[model samples]
Structure formats: C-alpha cells, structure tokens
Target: MEKQSRHIFSKVFTNAVLIIFSLSCIFPLIWMFYSSLKEKRVFNADVVGLPSNPTLKNYKRILENPDYHIFDSMFNSLRTTFLSVLLIILCGFIVGYIIARVQFKLNRVIYFVFLLGMLIPIHSLLVPIYIVFKNAGLTDKWYTLIIPYVAFGLPIAIFLVEGFVKGIPVALEEAAAIDGSSFSRTLFSIILPVTKPILTTIAIIQTFACWNEFSFALVLLSETRLQTVPLAMKQFSGQFSSDYPKIMAAMLLTMSPIIIMYFVFSKQIIKGMVAGAVKG
Candidate 1:
C-alpha cells in the first residue's frame, strides 16, 4: 500500500509538470490568436485578458489586399522549398547509400567532408558565397536561393538517410545484385522502397529548413518580386514600431502549412528518428 501510494504520488507530480509545460508552450499560440482577433485598443490596453470584441478584420484585410501579395510570397516560399528538398533528397539518397552500404577506403573521408558543413557557421561563409554568386551572375535569381538552401541542407539530410539506409539489411541488396540487377537499379528499386519512411522524414525536415531559412535568402534575394514570406512579412514592421495583429495573422498563415504537415506525418517522422537512432 505504501509503494502504491508512492507510485500514485509520482504520477500526479508528473502530470502536473507536463500540464504546466504544455500550457507554457501553447500559450504563445493562444496569445497570438487572441492578439490577431482583438481590437487594437484592447490589445494595447491589456494583452493578458480576453478581447472585449474579437474581429476577423485582420484576416479579411489580408485576404482582400491585392497590393501586399501575401499569396505570391507564400507561393515563392513553397516553390523554393520544394525544389531545394527534391534535389537534396535525390542527391542525399545516392550519397547516403554509398556511405551506408559500400565500404571504400575514402568513404570515411567523404562522410567527414559532408559532416564538415554542419560545423562551419553559415554566416562565416556569407561573404565568399556572395562573391561566388556575383561572379557566376546568379545573385538575385531563384537558383541562387535554391542552391544555397540545398547546399546547407545536404549534410543533415545525408546523415538522416544514411542512418536509415544502415538499418536496411545488406542481404536484400546482395540478392538483387546476384540476380543481375545493376547498382543503380537495385538502389532505386529495392533500397528506396524500404527507405521511404526515412526519406519522408528527411524531405520534411529539409522542407521546413528551406521554408524558414532567412539569412541566406535575405542576402541572396534582392527583388521585391522574388521575396519569400519571411522576407516579405518584414514590410509590416516600420522603422520605429510594428503592427502586432497583422503580423501575427500573417505568421499564422505562413506557419499553418508546416504545422499541418507535422500533424500529418508526425508518426512516420518519430518512427524514422527512432529507426535512424538505432541504426546509426
């Protein structure tokens, strides 16, 4: 009975802690939503309490405004993110397979070269990258944004996919090879099917990274027409102050897709992470 009481007490303590943590994390989202809906007067007067009269004006204004081009910015963000992730996944799959399965003398060196990227601060290379992009006549172009995103994102993607590839048994690939399947054929047909979960996880992570990337995009892209959501949203902030409600509304719009994606593939992502952890 004493032990039972102890376990019950522990459970209660854990529950209380978790409830507090959950509320703390979610409070921001609640506040953002409330601020977005509240009248400007109420928001300025008292931010903690509920709004006296909630209005959908901010959202409506956003949708109705043609000049702001929020949708265009969103489209640009989506386009760049998709293209970057696709290249990363394809290249990552090939390189990841080689490192995970094939044993070559230089394999470790090659893996370390990829791993080296993560250690270097991206800010450190900004100047060199800008010079190279300028000489290549690629700055201010869509490819400029996509290239840097893929380059920076490759290391993590390779690491994730390589870990997933290790979890796959060698016998399957060997059997396919013995039957006269080419290396490329075996990898695409046999290996890729089994690595789908990890691939999804890698793709999703790359998507989020590319979507939210600011520093590189800010420096690389100059045209107002080419601005992404993160960059375009800066317009809402003035030199001295910011429009809190409109900004929050825009943030909610920008963040909604990623949140939805997480909800949809969260199970696969968790499974992939667990599998990769064990394999790596």
Candidate 2:
C-alpha cells in the first residue's frame, strides 16, 4: 500500500510538471495567434492581453493585397520544399541501401565523404558558395536554393536510412532472390514497403529543414518575385515595423502549414525515430 501510494504520487507529480512545461511552450504560439487578431494600436497598448475585438483585416490585407505577394512566396516555398524533400528521400534511400547492403572497396570512402559534409559548418562555406554560384551564373535561379537544401539534407537522411536498412533482416532479401525476383524488383517491391516508417521520418525532417532554412535562401535568392517564405517574412518586418498585428498575422500564416504537418505526422515521427535509433 505504501509503494502504491508512492507510485501514484510520482505519477501525479510528473503529470503536473509536464502540463506546466507544455503550457509554457505553447503560450507564445497562442499569444502570437491571438495577438495577430488585434490592430497595431491594440497590440502596442497591451502586448500580453487578448484582443477584445478580433478582426481578419490583417489576414485579408496580406492575402488579398497584390503588393504583399504572400501567395507567391508560399508557392515558391512549397515548390522548393516539395522538390527537395522528394529528391532527398529517393536519393538517400538508394545510396544508404547500397552502402548498407553492397560490398565494395570504395564504399567506405564514399560514405566518409558524405559524412564529412555534416561535420563542416555551412556558414563557413557561404562566401565560397556565393563566388562559385556567381561565376557559374547559377545565382537567382529558381533551383538555386534547392541544390544546397538537397546537399545539406542528404547526409542526415542517408545516415538514418543506412542505419534503418542495416536493422532489416538479410533473410528477406535472400528469400526474394530465391523466388527469382530481379534485383530492382526485390528492392522496390520487397524492401521498399518495409522502410516506410524510417523514410517517412526522413521526409518530415528534411521538409522542416528545407522550409525553415533562411540563411541559404537569403544568400542564394535575390529577386522579390522569387522570394521564399523566410526571405519574405524578413523583408515584411523591415517594410512594416509599425504594423505589429500584420506582422503577427504574416508569421502565423507562414507557421500554419508546418504546424499542421507536425500535428498530423507527430506519431509517425516519434515511432520512426525510436525504431531507427534503437532497432539498428
């Protein structure tokens, strides 16, 4: 009875702590959201207080106004993020599978080279990358940010996929081989289905990375017509310092997609991370 009481007390204590922590983390987001509904004067008058009269004017202005171009920025961000995530997942799985399953002399060398990328600081290479892009005439292109996004994203993607693939039984592949399944057929049909969880996790991770990436986007892109969400948000702040409510609205708009994605895929993310990290 004493031990049972102790366990119950501990559970209560942990739950209380967790509830507080969660509320603390979520408070800023809630504040930002509600604050977005207020006018600039209201927000300035009482930053922490809730809006007594919420309005959709900020949202309408940003979305409906041709000058803001919020829609265009969203489209650019979506396009780059979608393309980058797709390529990262496809290439990461293929290369990681090869490195894990194949026996070759240069495998370790290639793996080492890829791993070297993660160790290097991206900020250190900005000047060099800019010079290279300038000389190559690749700057300001639609695909400029996509290249680095894929390149930087690949190392971690490959690492996770390689580890997860290693955890999968070799017997599965061997059994498929015995059935006279061609190599491509076995890889795509037999092995691919088994890797869904880890791949989903990789996709989510790379999506967040590509979407939130600001520095690379800033360095690689210049045209207002081609601006991504991060760049546009930054520029928005500079252009509308007085309009606090509109700024908050713009931030909320930018945050909505990622927030929705996280809530939907939250379970898959936790499961995949645990499986990939522990199983292998």
- Distance (Å) between predicted and true CA of 34, model 2? 0.7
Local accuracy by lDDT, each model: 0.85, 0.88
Q: Per-residue CA lDDT of candidate 1, range 1-280, in tens?
A: 9999999999999999999999999999989998999766777788788877889998988889886788888888988998999999899999989998889899999999999998999899888998899888998886679988889988987887787887788899889989999988998999988887777778867887889888877888888778898897888788987778888898998888778878887888888767655555
Q: Tens-digit lDDT track for model 2 on 1-280?
A: 9999999999999999999999999999999899989988999999999999999999998988887778788889999999999999999989999999998999999988999988999989998999999899999998999898899999988887888888899999999999999989988898888888888888878888888888988888889888899988875565436687898899899888888878887888888777655666
Best candidate (score: lDDT): 2
Per-candidate TM-score against the hidden true structure: 0.91, 0.93
